[model samples]
Target: MFTRILIANRGEIAARVIGTARRLGIATVAVYSDADAGARHRDLADEAVHIGPAPVSESYLKGDRIIAAALATGAEAIHPGYGFLSENPEFVEAVEAAGLVFIGPSAASIRAMGLKDAAKALMSSVGVPVVPGYHGERQEAGFLAAEAARIGYPVLIKARAGGGGKGMRLVEAPADFAAALESAQREGRSSFGDPAVLVEKYVSTPRHIEVQVFGDRHGQLVHLWERDCSLQRRHQKVIEEAPAPGLPPEVRRAMTEAALRAARAVDYVNAGTVEFIADGSGPLRPDGFWFMEMNTRLQVEHPVTEAITGLDLVEWQLRVAAGERLPLAQAEIPLAGHAFEARLYAEDPARNFLPAPGPLLHVAFPDGARIDTGVGTGDRITAHYDPMIAKLTTHAATRAEALSRLRRALGQTHIAGTATNLGFLRALCEDPDFAAGRMDTGLIGRRQEALTRVPPPDDAAVLFAALAALDLDPARPFLGFRLWGSASRRVELVSGGTLVARDLRLLGPRHVAVEEGDRSTAFEAVAATPDGFRARHGGRNLHARVVRAGGAVSVLLDGRITDFSVIDPLAVEAAGGAAENRITAPMTGLVCAVPVTAGATVARGDILVVLEAMKMEHSLRAASDGTVEAVHCAVGDPVGDGTLLVEFTPAARRPDEAADG
Candidate 1:
């Protein structure tokens, strides 16, 4: 094996590679941009080097700078994790030219699959199943539209050079084809610098499944079964599983064989994935699946596959790069129990899953399961990179057990300082269709409203927190040595938009009575920890981690940490509020275009503006019909959440309508 290797990537993948290298006794080098200077991966590697700025074009994509860093650190090979330069054929050639081994497929293999149209044609010629679509070289808009017409309605326009859904569009009718094509091309150009596109038949209910395969220098190859990546939002994977649930043994065998054939067709070596879009109307079949594309490097969900197979794919990459033959043959590799992986991202699901970036004040991950993370507490989730915090994976004897463990693990996690999709993920775990394995690409979107529903804290939990906060001061005894009956203290708590005022009468060290307005509720408290209280109300056990701050109490109940500005009842009765139609930016991104003009009339749900952030276009819409008063930002401007985009006044008939909040 090589003595030292350099990872030409960042984030969790870099940290993952460093971990494997350490176990194998291989020295590792990490490359970082200015944004990732204090990142966890930088400290994990044996040596680190600064590449360039935060933008990928100047930093991670600079293959020459990466190569120089590798050589300077005495790295014998470079591992391109999965993005940036991972699939860049030219970068592979450059690395090979510098006398350093590229720990992945050859440049020739990557070139063979660089463009979707070309790659589809190549796969078809080699007897592999290719989706029925337009794989021609013509790029004219009219020509592509005709191809879409030929393919039938509901055609997909995908960037020939795109991944991660950046340059993909689904058109339901001929009238929408032109607009979809323009959007796809623009995104493709901005993301990959190549706007070339290919039209394909859109599967009505798609289930994304992919086969993992690896090859050695001596031409020996084996397949590592498949992963079901059907859980998605905005065409990106949110959850994945190995030994796909409800998949049959026959289908598994066929997929493995087809994957090996595709790799052998290209004389492929190293680790790669062959993705497929399966029809979800029935169980997977040999003929029911069609090739999507090949990821020419290690995948983000490779951990699930590793857990099931009991093998280290990165170690295999190192062995193959060192001129070794295949370590295990197809027959020797075993498929064990089921595994599931959930990607925890710093995003707000309620805000249409917008990326939430900020300093991670406290990040606490579950202990039992394996967690692959690139950031820790004090790490800043920069907008210049993906906002993923970690990948939590669980493995067990069966799919049901794996999912149950996954739910428990997620519930045990604690994170603060930024919004996340944890609540949404928790809802998914309890979703009927998801738990029953009736999943498709559109599952999340179909149940979006219910899945993103916010639940308010129970009244009993709130009352316990109020009582606990009162005892935080040691000088104030349990009964306060009161001369009369128990001295009652009034406190106010707000959660999930519901405000409640509680009257706390401390009965004793383990008992209290709470009164909200004229109604009264009894609570029994047991001191679990000095900082938190365990309370029981109406037969349900609840935990309240109470922290005293600014004469108020912040209570963390049921994993949803909330702050309650506790104030004297007489001090807050004077405040009041009104309903308003306030416009706010959905996410931190550049204002790509403002469609509304000053004083223009826009109806409800009208497209007011478009913001581009994290390489995705989000259209800010008008919630009510009104006359536009102002636009707070211009095109090409950077804005954050709640950044005003436009203001509106009611129609002349209701000129005195209430303001928007």
Candidate 2:
């Protein structure tokens, strides 16, 4: 085993690697960018080094800097944890050439699977059931169009070197193919430095299932069963599970064998995953799955596989990299119960799942589940990296039981300071099709409106917060001795777009009554707690963590966070509201494109600006038909949140009120 190793990554994966390395008594070194100077992974490791600035091109992707750090820290090997330089074949070769081990597959193996078109061809040649599509080398737009026509409409255009839903587009008709291809090529070039893409027939109802395989230098290999990653949003996985629910036994056997064959074809070693796109129109069949691509490193969803197998995959990687034999043969590998993993990300589901990066003012994960995370309270989810806060994993005797535990665990999650997709994840857990295991890649897209709708916070909890905010005394207002005089006050609070005024009267010590419209509710035990207050209403006890910053009050109750902006009668506001057709940056990020000029006219839904943040490209479209009055940003400009990117006025398409926020 390696006496010391360096993790060439950041976030949870870096932290995760340190955990296993420490357990094995291996000294660990962590590399961080300027943005991650205070990252948990840096502190968790035995030693830390600063590589470069926050931009990936300057930091995490600088293999030479990472190698220097590793050598300086006396690391025997480097572990690329799934992202950054994880799958870079050149980086792997460089590490090996530097007289240090690369704790993953060889450079040749990664190169073989680097490009989707070539990977598919290789798998098809090896009889691994490649998906039917255009895997040719021609990159001409017209040639690709003809191939898409030959395959059929509803073709999926994927970047040859893309992963994580980047540079992927699904075209439903021939007319939309050109635009999607251009967009895909642009994103692919910017993200992966490769503009080549492949056209594949889109599986209308598809399930993403992958098999985990491990190998050693001693020519021994084994499979760790499979994981179902069908729950996805925007082509990215949101939830994952092991021992796919409702999967047929025969199908599982065939898939596992195929995965081993694919791995063995390239003499693959260490940990890797063979992804498949399966037909989900009916029961899983042996012929329903086709090879998509192979990830040449540990996967983000590997925890689900670990929970089921009860094995430390990272430890296995270390052993294999140190010239040891495989831990267990295919049959010897233990596969017990079902497991589920839900990814909690700092994003706004209601805003089309845009990345919401800010300080994690309050973060609390419930017990009873294994949480793999690199962030906690006081940490910031910057736009420079992925916005994943943590991966919550649950394991049980059965799939149903495991999913139930997952739902319960999510219910107790508390986070504030920025928007999150917790509400969306909770809704997905309760979704009928998801709970019943009738899942597919298109599940989220089909029910996006319902899933993204955030549930309202507990009323009693919000009322108690309002009452507390109304108190003039800042210190222990909830514990005031108001028994001698029952004072009444009216306070106004606004949530989302709704405003309400309520009358609050002290009924007794630590008790109050609130009146709004014709409804009167009584709150008992209204005492202040360390973080917030607890109250009883309608025979139910409610707990809320109330935080007041300036006039904004945020209340978290039962994992639902609501920000209430207190209305002030003494404050004067400017009139005329925000300008029409004005679009601003949603978060701090680099501008990838300025599609429109100052005098250009654009229709609603037309691409105006493309912003790159959290390593993903987001296209900001016009909200109405308007003429651009100004283009304030250009490509490659780093802009902050709410920075005006474009200004425009309605072009008389309809009433201006239709454009009001």
Candidate 3:
């Protein structure tokens, strides 16, 4: 085994690799950018090196700097953990050229599957079922449109060079084809530096299932079963599980065999995933699935596979890189139990899942579930990198038990200073279709409203915040609530952009009556755990925990977290008015484009500015027809959250009004 190794990545994956290397008694070196200077991964490694600036192109993607770091740190091999430079063939070649082992497949294998169009063609040649579409080299818009017509409506146009839902669009009809293609090409060029795209049939009921395959240098190959990653939004996997739920044995066998075939065709080495898009419309059949693409590296969802198989995949990678034989024969691998992985991202589900990048003032994950994270309390989720805060994985004897554990763990996760999708994940766990294993790619999109809807803070939550803000001891009664009997204490809270004032009356120790407006709910503590108080309200018991940080009180009640800003008595409130004419950035990002100039008239819904953040583009548009007064930021400018980008003349007239005048 190599004495030392380097992880050429950041975030949870970097931390994950360092842990395995440490367990194996190998010194680990970590590379960091300016943004990740104080990252957990940097501190976890035995040695750390600064690569470059915050941008990935200048830091993580710089293969030469990384190789130099690995060589300087005496790393025998480099492990590209999943993203960034993981699947880049050129990086792998550079590492090998530097006389260091690349702990993954050869450059040929990655190059074989790098492009979607070519990979589809290769899979077809290798006898793997591939989706019926155009994988041709022609880039003509008319040619692609004709092919889409030939394939039928509802075709998917995706960039050939990159994944992650970028440079991809779904066209339902011919009328939308041209615009979608243009957008996809533009994004493809900007993101992947390749404008090539392929058109494919859009499956109506798609379930994303992929088989984990491992190969050693000696040509020994094996399969690590499958993971169902159907729970997705914009092509990004949200929740994943091993031993794909409700999969027929025959279908599973066929998919695994095909996956092995694809790997063999590429002479693949180390760990790789062969993803398939299967029909969730009915019982899985051998012919009901088609090849999507092969990820030429370890997957983010590998923990579920590891949980069921009872093996360390990273160790396998290390052994394989050291030219070892396969650890076990295909039949000897275990699949004992079910496992589920939930990706907890620092994002707001209400605001279209916008990435919420800010400091993690407080961070507390549940004790039981395995958490893979890089950020901690006082750390920041910056706009310069992916906003995935952590990945929570749970394993149990059954799928139901595993899912239940996942939901429980999500509820226990406490974070402050940024919005998260914890509540949405809890709601998704309760989704009937998902709970019963009848999920599909469209499940989230279908139930998006119900899933993302933030429930108004209940009386219990508001009362908890009030108590925490007041620093009242719930275990003991106080005469405070004004000074006399029949007096109520009024405390103000801001929740969901609205102000709420609750009146609390102390009935007795461990008992309180909370009233908001015309309604009243009495809460009495039945029990108190270290985390929170279990109280009985309206004949039922519930739990509530409150934590205060940086002038904000956050209350976690009944599996939901709500942040309430305490109203300062000495502070004056600002009067509210409709500021719809002002167009500001929703989050920190780069001003990619200002389509409108100063004094330019724009109609409602017209694009004014294109801000790119967290690897996604958002078009800020006109709220209503108005003339632009100024464009504050130009293209290539970095902007912070709520930074005003453009302003329209206040109460600007519509086109019809101007014509009449």
Candidate 4:
């Protein structure tokens, strides 16, 4: 094995590679940009190298700079972790020219499967089942539209050089084809610098299943079963599992064999994934699966495969890069148990899953699970890269057990200072259809309302926050007693943008009554421990964990994390101010476009500006009918969160409305 290697990526994947390298006694070097100077991955490596600025183009995407760093640090090889330079054929060629081993497929192999259209053609030539589509090289808009018409309605326009759902659109009719194509091409150019796209038949009910395959320089190849990644939002996988449930035995065998054929056809080496979209109209069969695309590098969900197979895929990548033969025959690699992986991201599900980058005040993962993360408490989640916080995975002997464990693990995860999808993940795990394995790519879309609903703070959560804010000990006598008798204190909490005030009357040392409006509930604490408070309310006993960070308090109650901001009622009342009719950037990002100019009249819900951040586009809309007073930002200008982008003047009020007021 090579003694020293450089990881040519950032965040969790880089840290993940470092872990395996350390276990194998191989020294690892990590490269970082200006934004990731103090990143966890760099701190974990044996040595670190400063590349360039935070922008990926100047740092992570600069193949020559990365190669130079590797050579200067005496790294024997470079491991391009999933994204960025991982699938770039030119980068692979550059590394080879520098006489450093690239810990992945060769440049030729990557080129063969780099573009979706070309890869589809290659798969078809090799007898691999492929989705019917136009894989031609023509880029004219009219020709693409004609091809979509021939394919029938509800066709998909996918960028030839795209991944992670960027540069993809589904057109339901010919009328929308032109606009969708234009949008797709624009995103394609912005994201991949390639405007080429292909038209494909959109599967009405699709389940994403991919087979993990490995090959060595000695020409040995094998498949590591499959993972079902049907749970998706915005065309990105949210939850993934290994040993795909509800797949027929014959289908599994055929899929694995087909994957092996695809690998051999490209002369592929190292770790790669052959993705397939299966028809979910009925029971899964071998004939219902068709090739979608091949990811020419390690996948984000590879941990689920590792959990099921009891093998380290990163180690395999290193061994193959070192010219070692296949570690085991196909039959020797056993699939023992079912596993599930939930991608915990720092995003607000209610805000259409908008990326919310901020400091991680408190970060804690559950026990009995594997957490692969690149950030910790006190770390800032920068907008320069993906907003994925961690990948939590669990394995069990049965699918039911695995799902249950996954749900429990998600509930146990604690985070603060920024919004997260922990509640959404918990709801997904508890979904009946998901539990029964009736999942598809549209599952999240179909059940979005229920899955993203933010539950109100319960009484237990309010009480816990009150105790933490007041520094009151439930075990002590006369905790909230006045000179004459029990005291009544008003506690104010803010949750999910709604402010709630409750009156707490201390009846005794361990007893209190909480009054909210006309409703009141009495609770008696059995004991107060460092972990949580066990209390009885409404004839039921419950334990709620209290996590206090700064002025924010998060209570984990009944598998739901309810955050509360303990506020002073007097201060809140005194600080009230008139609303400023201004549209601000929701998060730090570059202003992509300003749709409205000064003095332009726009109705509520009209898009005023578009901001690009975290690899996604978000629009700032007018809050009310108003005229744009001034445009504060121009296209290509970088802005921070809450930075005013546009100022608007409210429309004139009617005479009757003014008289009433």
Window of ten residues with lowest summed lDDT in model 2: 472-481
As for candidate 1, its clashing pairs are 580-659, 580-660, 580-661, 581-660
TM-score of 1: 0.91
Put down candidate 4 lDDT per residue, 582-605, tens digits, no spaces. 777778999877888998989988
Model 1 per-residue lDDT tens digits across residues 470-550: 554322435552436646766666654457676776666656667767877766654556756677777877776665544
How far out, in Å, is residue 503 in model 2?
2.8
What lDDT score is found at residue 378 in candidate 3? 92
Q: Any idea what lDDT model 2 has?
A: 0.88
lDDT of 3: 0.89
Runs off by more than 4 Å, candidate 4:
481-486, 568-581, 598-606, 622-630, 648-661
- What TM-score goes with each of the models? 0.91, 0.95, 0.95, 0.95
Kindly report which residue pairs in candidate 4 clash with one another. none
Clashing residue pair totals per candidate (backbone < 3 A): 4, 0, 0, 0
lDDT-wise, the better of 2 and 3 is 3
Write model 3 residue lDDT over 1-661, tens digit each, in one string.
9999999999999999999999999999999999889999999999999999999999998999999999998999999998788888988888998999999999999999999999988898889999999988999999999999999989999999878788888899999998789878978887888999999999999999999999998878999999999999988899999999999899999999999999999999999999999988999899999999999999999999999998999999999998889889898999989999999999999988999988888898988899999989999999988899999999999999999999999999898888999999999999988999999999999899999998788888877777777776665564576475565788887887888877887777777888877888888873445765677887887877767886788888777899988888899876895476678899998887788899897788888998888988888878777789888999889999889999886335546667888
TM-score rank order: 3, 4, 2, 1
